[model samples]
Target: MLYAGTRHRDYTLRVPLAGDLVDAQEAHPQGLVRLVALDLYRRQLLQLGEIPAEAITLELLRSELTEIDMAELERADAELGKRFAPPRPGSSTGAASSTPSSVTATPSPTSGA
Candidate 1:
């Protein structure tokens, strides 16, 4: 299912997997959606060989992701049975977040203590 993209699509819009988080952590280091986009498109970019990956900044990709029309993308997300999420870069409040906000960790007692 297509989760995010625009009319003239720049990257593959396939559903992002949970494993993507681990992969994205090493490289993209951006929000899930933007990381997903970069994870999908970075190597294949016609510009990648010309410029090092480090040279590409989050703002550059964010500019591309910010243009996606949320109305259609959000509808597609629902159709795919995905929870609502804003694909806008740096947003992780909803489904875009791999970890639920409701989760709280209680401190575990240390064996040494």
Candidate 2:
């Protein structure tokens, strides 16, 4: 997944985990890995804003996450997913009408509480 940061930022992040993360997100709905990965990617980009394209590496991202941050990231990730995830198949909700909204377009402010 090529994630664009805030709309104002010109850089794009190539998330290597995008495929597996989406798979886990839909398949293992209760898992936190996808959420963690999402938070890590966002933080990595924000922390290193306007850097060279080649500077965005998996190691740099992994280095920023800790076990203590997992709980917060998990919560934020769940909230972000809930707000953005497409309605499940055969569900009855207005969100179903808005399916296919761009998830990788920009980062939203998910309450960290």
Candidate 3:
């Protein structure tokens, strides 16, 4: 999911685990692997000091977890995700588009009367 920060910049944070991570395995064949994966993700986030310990519970961690602590966490996560994940399809990689519309274009210079 993408988060907009205080600076009004859009940042994307991608959770790495794929749907196959939840596939039934001999050790954990009940399809609980996704839960385990989420736990690990939450622990990693906590280790990074992103979300507080109180926010690390299974319920809170499993649910959509954009909390008050997410501003900085989202920023950091976005940076990390950018470094790790491939650029999203059709996403701009360079500086954000700052071009003004044609309606706001400056008038061209003309010869003095």
Best-performing candidate as measured by lDDT: 2
Predicted structure 1: clash tally: 0
Better of 1 and 3 by lDDT: 3
Error of 1 at 65 (Å): 3.2
How many clashing residue pairs appear in each of the predictions shown? Answer: 0, 0, 0
What is candidate 1's CA lDDT for residue 60? Answer: 51
TM-score of 1: 0.29
Once fitted onto the true fold, the runs of candidate 2 whose alpha carbons sit more than 4 angstroms away are: 1-18, 21-48, 65-76, 84-91, 95-100, 105-113
Q: Model 3: runs farther than 4 Å from truth?
A: 1-15, 19-55, 59-66, 87-113
In model 2, the number of clashes is 0
Of candidate 2, the 10-residue stretch with the lowest lDDT total is 6-15
Instruction: Choose the strongest candidate by TM-score.
Output: 2
List clashing residue pairs in candidate 3: none
Worst 10 contiguous positions by lDDT, candidate 1: 104-113
By lDDT, the candidates rank as: 2, 3, 1
In candidate 3, what are the lDDT values of residues 1-113, reduced to their tens digit?
11122211222223444442343233345546555654434433423223444644546544544443344444454555556567799988897569642211111122100
TM per candidate comes to 0.29, 0.34, 0.28
Select the stronger candidate by TM-score from 1 and 2.
2
